[model samples]
Target chain A: MPLGLNSPQIVLLGVNHNTAPVEVRERLSLSGSNTPALRLFAELPSCEEVVFLSTCNRVEVLVSTNRLDEIRESITKLWLDRGKMDSNTLQGALYEYHGTSAIRHLFRVASSLDSMVVGEPQILGQLKDAYRMASEAKTAGLVLNRLLHKAFSVAKRIRTETRIASHAVSISYAAVELAKKIFGDLTGKNGMLIGAGEMAELAAQHLIAGGADKLVVANRTLSRAVELSRSLGGSAISLEEVGDALVDADIVISSTGAPGIILSKDQVKRIMRPRRHRLLFFIDIAVPRDIDPKVNDIDNVYLYDIDDLKGVIEFNKAEREKEASKADRMVEAEVIKFMAWMESLNVVPVIQHLQEKAEAVRQKEILRSHKVIESLNDEQQKAMDVLTRSIVQKILHDPIVYIKKGAQKKNSEMILDAACSLFGIDGLEDTQKLQDKCLSDANQDKTIRKPSPN
Target chain B: MHKFLFQITVFIYFVSTVGFLVHIITLRKDAERIATVVLSVGFGFHTAAVLMRWFVGGHPPLVNLHDSLSFLAWAMVGSFLLFQWRCKLKSLGAFVIPFAMIIMTASSFQSKEILPLPPVLKSIWLPIHAIICLFADAVFALAFCIAIMYLLQERQIKKKRLGAVFQRLPSLETLDAMNERCLTVGFPLLTLGIVTGSIWAEKAWGSYWSWDPKETWSLITWFIYAALFHQRLTVGWRGRKAAIMTIIGFAVLVFTFLGVSLLLSGAHSYATWLK
Candidate 1:
């Protein structure tokens, strides 16, 4: 028979970027004003605590409840009714994890290992926000509070030990990285943007952050260039003066949609002779190739098109994937440790039952013997009571050690069931209430050492 | 006794080579530390064997194929270790230690008997010329390793086929900078070696510029690196072009050191020292 404590199990139901489309996810996403959702979850049968996490890519509900079936059905119905989505269409889109698997999932999500980018740092902040909202709404209790704190520590550990977030994984980031490769140091260098387009402006911002001493934005329209440059604390120049401007600029970022080549080999070659000491890096992130390809042949010139930036992003993605596996191992280890702690907790109630049953039998035998031996002195009766208690204690020692040791190992449920049967323990559902009381008492004694509700 | 020490050194180097290769494949940080330790042990043994040979033979041990190969391996390991200390480039040991192992293995196949020094070689310039030339070759070997790594990193970045191997290697910027450093330091040492050798040549052979194949190839190697330096200083060839140029220069240098002595007939065809 299964060990019966009627304790609440952790249940997690979610839809992430991989499982649901943006439209479906948005329909389920809860805002900070999620009092309605919180009230609905709190009213669910047997739900002791709940936390709802909603972000652009995912919407998750984590709950601790004994009636898993009732909570799952109620939450599914509530989500479907709110979204007005057909159950058939969204049937296989939702994922549900329970017990240890649920806890592991929470840790992975908090650490950003389950993110779309694998290593983005935004998920931790979003998780913290979800936790805070749950706290304010009175939906989170002792169980979830502890779980969330543990998840935060796990996330912090993974971030400290891995290079998952160290590399650039975006197109704009790749452009900056390439500039660094050429110049060694971006400080004390001049960065010039050839067009006032969004991509050029983004690259200009990255260059400025990289410590470029000067920024020059050049465009066909002088007013647009000036407006963009002024906002970034840089100067603007007309496109006609770009050739002369190239003499001082160390890095050039071009993303104009013009049909013709903006910079040619002869133009760059002519400029290189006058500025022979400086290296020229051309980031041509344009469709029709703003900078001429032949210009790459010119001395001291390095040109990278959009395709090159894509390569850098791909490489960085692969690197993050490698680090993800290391994070996975860490998550697995933490899950095992948490499971062991839970198992030890489940055995606590069984141990209490066994000891209490033995004490009741010993007390009855002692009181009966005291009446039969009323001729003896009160001191003699007390000595007999002490003697029986010592005998019972000596008999209980080996069994207690055996059960506690078994609880630390795997498959601790079988050991707990055996102890309950051997002791003739009954009414476990009633004992669950006692277990809950004792858990709160233990938590009061030491918050981190509380019995697992499982 | 020295031969036994040389064998042990070779075995240690082989183990270190495996260690570094595993570090590259697995990306285990502990493997890097272990490999460096093993390589240092091998270097210590190799140094002991070389010193023993020098003392017993009453020379610098530059008399035969075996001695020259052993000396080259020693120099390669020494320079690579020095670079590792300065740069902490663990991935680089994957390339350099294995190259040293191959040279040591080749040296093991040659006869271990020490041959008598030639009467013509009995001069103060002998040690000076050989030591300086070997030091130049060792520095070039490091440059070659960095150049190859630069090309590999550049290829992965360009082709977009990055895997675990790509991540284990150093960044393209780091490899490029290290290559440039090799040139800045190595070129002067090479120029000094050639100048000292030419001076020794005039004293010994009554000529400063013999058209010997080794001397001619050495000049060609020098010119290749000179061209590299010129382009690097004047035009600032930064990434891929610079890497490819250094690779080409390394090829000519290898040919000058090995091919000219072993394949061609010349006064400096010193491979017959064993015979």
Candidate 2:
């Protein structure tokens, strides 16, 4: 992709859950290198502000800088170091979204509309945790804090006030449901789980393929299998007697740590003779090897390993995408809300600036004509002051009116920028400083205000 | 100054009340703002006229039927001003200012003789009681305005009209907050006023609970408003239910203020201000 010359003042450089893999991500986890990345981010002379959100799925560096080339260089160097990439390999596999798109992306990510799992609630909490940690580390400041908080509020409105989260089934729930469909009323069924994992425990629960006549937990370690069996209301069996277990078992799910196949073709063939090829279902779930591929060729045997689960997962993925379309609509509305908040921020400063400017003009003119104004005397001056203030207020009202109208359209930013530029709103520098100081300080003075009885 | 301001006050308030009706039903902004300004001007004129009456009459202006009606009208406007400060329901001036103006007109028609103050109303507590109750009523009236706005806004949202009025009107949540705030401030004030009035009534009538139309309707008013506040806080009341309840509460207050006084021929015998 060609990079535009008029790139945004700030650019984001990173991969998210949408890009990159777990193996590549785990190494670049921000926790390992820790303070150096943040220090470097701060130390870079061109980088005004920096925030890094490093989740298991993604590692990103958000920088505030008008200098694009310099920020890009620093970000690229950081990525290479984190990814342990060769210099030549920095060619592709990286992406950038600038300015509005970048901010919108942050909002979406914080709201979890862009998560690997659609409408998954955990991403929001994770993002918040990242933001909080950044704050405590003195890495995330006012801009990020405000952006994140506003994003959270937008998300909250979407979650509470919309049906965006309705009927969102978890992966575990889908897995169990699939199991029940395959088993078709699991009463008086004998099943053996070859490994004792959380998945097996969950599968053994009453929600899923339960009500087995006998449940066997076979593991390399007999104690572990025994413990798993006890927790899951089943019996323990050894990996050595795996063939014997397979003979009696109506269903077999094998997920064990084996350097090679524990149940080879020869073993299954012998078991077939003893068991008379009883209609058995075999599910091999281990990463390397648990059951032999040749064993699947036996007659009256149905086999579905991890690879077959992929097809089912793909179907689930498509369904999740359909649900995510609904979530996306919610996200779009939420983005508009957040934009409104940001626009309101833009309008507020301009309003305050206008008010202050008008007040200054009124005070200066009154003070300049103090002697001539004395004909009005004390009572008349007070009345005239009130009248003058009202006139000023009336005069000062129209732009705020327009600004409010423009607020709904997200045009407030352009309006504010133009106003600040046109009026030479240098006072805003002081205002910005004041805002930062307020944020940095502890908010100890909390008051619950109740109006006085009329 | 006294007679001139009084007539102008009554005229402007009456005109603004028409404006209020126009704005409330048609929901016109210019009419609303105009009504607010007109009623504000009327309030200014009323204050001037009432001040003159007190100064010229050499009394607290609660001395006779005429004086008391004038005082009641003054109290209503005063209460309206107090609420308008916080409530931001200046549109309500169209309804309330006319009510006040009509009371002033009624006072003008009453016998202008300066009768001696009844010993019952002579106590310092009577003014305080009257002031607090009237102000609480104003707050309730403001809540009624919020409730109306809430209903209108709710209707617009439900219909998805998204018009200018809908845009300007605060959200249902905001209106709910305003209604709650009004009740929060108004309730205790009403409580104090009722306590004071009851104490003064005990001294004069030799019984606190006389079941006079005024007293009975006042309790009814209190019960209705108290129920509104309770329903809102306790029952998680919002939107149409709260809005309808608020409207009903205001109707009860108006009935206590006007109906019990005129139609019912109670101890509170104020001649009908409306022609």
Docking quality category of candidate 1 according to DockQ thresholds: incorrect
Report the TM-score of the second chain of model 1 against its true counterpart: 0.96
Best by lDDT: 1
Model 1, A349-375: lDDT tens per residue? 677777887999998886777667687
Candidate 1 achieves a global lDDT of 0.80
> Candidate 1, after superposition: displacement of residue A16 in Å?
4.1
Q: Mind listing the fnat for each candidate? A: 0.18, 0.00
Cα interface RMSD of each candidate: 4.7, 27.2
lDDT of 2 by residue, A1-454 (tens): 1111111233466665545556555645545675656665667776766777777766667765646547677767766676577655343445565544556667667766677665567777877776776677676655566767777876676566443453225433443333433344456667788877676565556432455678888987899999988877788988777778777886677777677777877777777656643445666667775788777665445456665555455555555566555656766666556545543544565666667878988999899989878877789899989988999989767866876677567454466555656656665644444443332221221111211211
DockQ of each: 0.23, 0.01
Candidate 2 regions with alpha-carbon error over 4 angstroms: A1-10, A16-36, A43-49, A64-88, A107-122, A137-143, A150-174, A179-224, A231-310, A336-349, A372-391, A410-454, B1-275
